[model samples]
Target: MSLAPRAVLVHRTTEYEELLARHGTAGQAAFFLTSRGRDLEPVAARHARARRTLAAVEAAVPLHWRRARVERADLDRFLFGPEDVVVVVGADGLVANTAKYLTGQPVVGVDPEPGRGLGVLVRHRPADTARLLTAAVRPDAAFDELTMVEAVADDTQRIRALNEIYLGAPGHQTARYRLATATRPDPAAPEESQASSGVLVGTGTGATGWLRSLWRERSGPPALPAPTDPRLLWFVREAWPSPTTNTTLVQGALTNGDHLRLVVESDRLVAFGDGVETDALELTWGQTIRVGLADLRLRLLV
Candidate 1:
């Protein structure tokens, strides 16, 4: 017999909870914020809303459907089953963060504090949970397939992100690497050695975040891709020009078959996706990685 559909509710620790944990009590937490000229009432209210949202979503799950709850910090260790229907409750970033761990499961993003967020990914509210959960379990349900980017190291370490990926030093120092692209029509072009802040490769869903700020700073020809576009954009941040390095190749787009290749020249470099640094791939000197569109897309329930 086939397994019953499962609902996996995902959430993160709230600011109020963090404050209480650090200060040891709600009164102390309020005092700490008050001393800093900040109000704790808003934080506490938001936390209450988040808790209520989670409870409503959980209650909406059918009793016959298996269910599980996962905190954002534990996503890296969570094992997602093939029949899982993911429900992420929080800001839009939480959806992006959860997208990296999933395969093709239909995801329903629920916003706890609605107007405060961008409302791009977390587009649903707590009241919509029961209906959305029913739709999500249907094999014929409609969903938007959002693009994702992936970086695969030659050693086989790979990472995927729904928003964008960052490759750079783990510290404040510059990242040293040799950059090249396979999409160039002229195959004989030489790779450039770069010494800069880092490299950023993002998807269309990412265009609303860090990629949008970069796009606004320049007059561009290749426009940013749509949320479901199969293309990706790469930018080399603060590419410095020196005797040994060049800044000519700073930005470009990667289509379906295109890839950006980076060979580590520094002693150590790190590659992280969706701003999750703890779950990242560390590369040493001479390691090579190729960044491109991931085969797996985020099936976001509309």
Candidate 2:
């Protein structure tokens, strides 16, 4: 007596033929998420996998892949218009890739990444690794309006950006600190607190990539909002103080109210973005620079 319609996905669904058949009937469109040419070349003689299944899938469903943006050719094909009933074989790239291309259609992340089952890391399963961490992400508004990419946004599906945000220093030199504030020309006077090295601020979508790691030390992991609540700023660095200082100011104060200030005693200070050199911000023993969330946001297709 149920009237809801269903669709089948055939990317890695070689074993779900019956299920596919059930969903493919009654004039409903089936959606399949496949590697296209992204799949590794098959062996010289073995075609026992979904190669034939994919061909049958072509006959089964009218593929509605992403094609929304030139930069997202790989992902754009997967996103369908809002009125479509969609099913997809989601993986790391597929899920993250789907964010920019989804057309507001109701979609099921089918054949998702083995570990998480579904959500975020959809179907990126490894042949060797069994356990993997999964997180949801959106986009940063600061860079969304950009027509061309001058600087690759923080969450550009690039692995390097995530690694820099989560991983700490190699040895134990300590993540040094300088003030990240709004005031120009920096601060003076040592009356406040000692600044720690690089702190990271995140929107909700970025919470899983960097905030979760820092939460292990300070706050616990919260839900993934489009951009998290109260806005997140992370202090990532390996420069733990030598215990010689009198007072250490962690996530200190700022005049902007929402911002934070860091005061380090040493002049060997630098401001790095993610993990690259941003600029050599010269500072005195006591100075204040404001740090707060930027007025930007991102939209993700889920």
Model 1 — which ten-residue stretch has the worst lDDT?
A: 181-190
Q: Which ranges in model 1 have alpha carbons more than 4 Å from their true place?
A: 182-189
Candidate 1: Cα lDDT at 260: 91
Could you report the Cα RMSD, in angstroms, for every candidate shown? 1.4, 14.7
lDDT of 2 by residue, 1-302 (tens): 43222232414323244434555632221233122332112221123333443333334342332212122233323434443333445443343333333333333343322454435533332221111111111122111210000111222321112112221122223434443332323445333323244455443444555555665565343443343243444444333555543223333221222444455445434332233332223434444343444332222223
lDDT of 1: 0.92
Against the true structure, candidate 2 reaches a TM-score of 0.37
* Candidate 1 per-residue lDDT over residues 83-122, each given as its tens digit: 9999999899999989999999999999888799788999
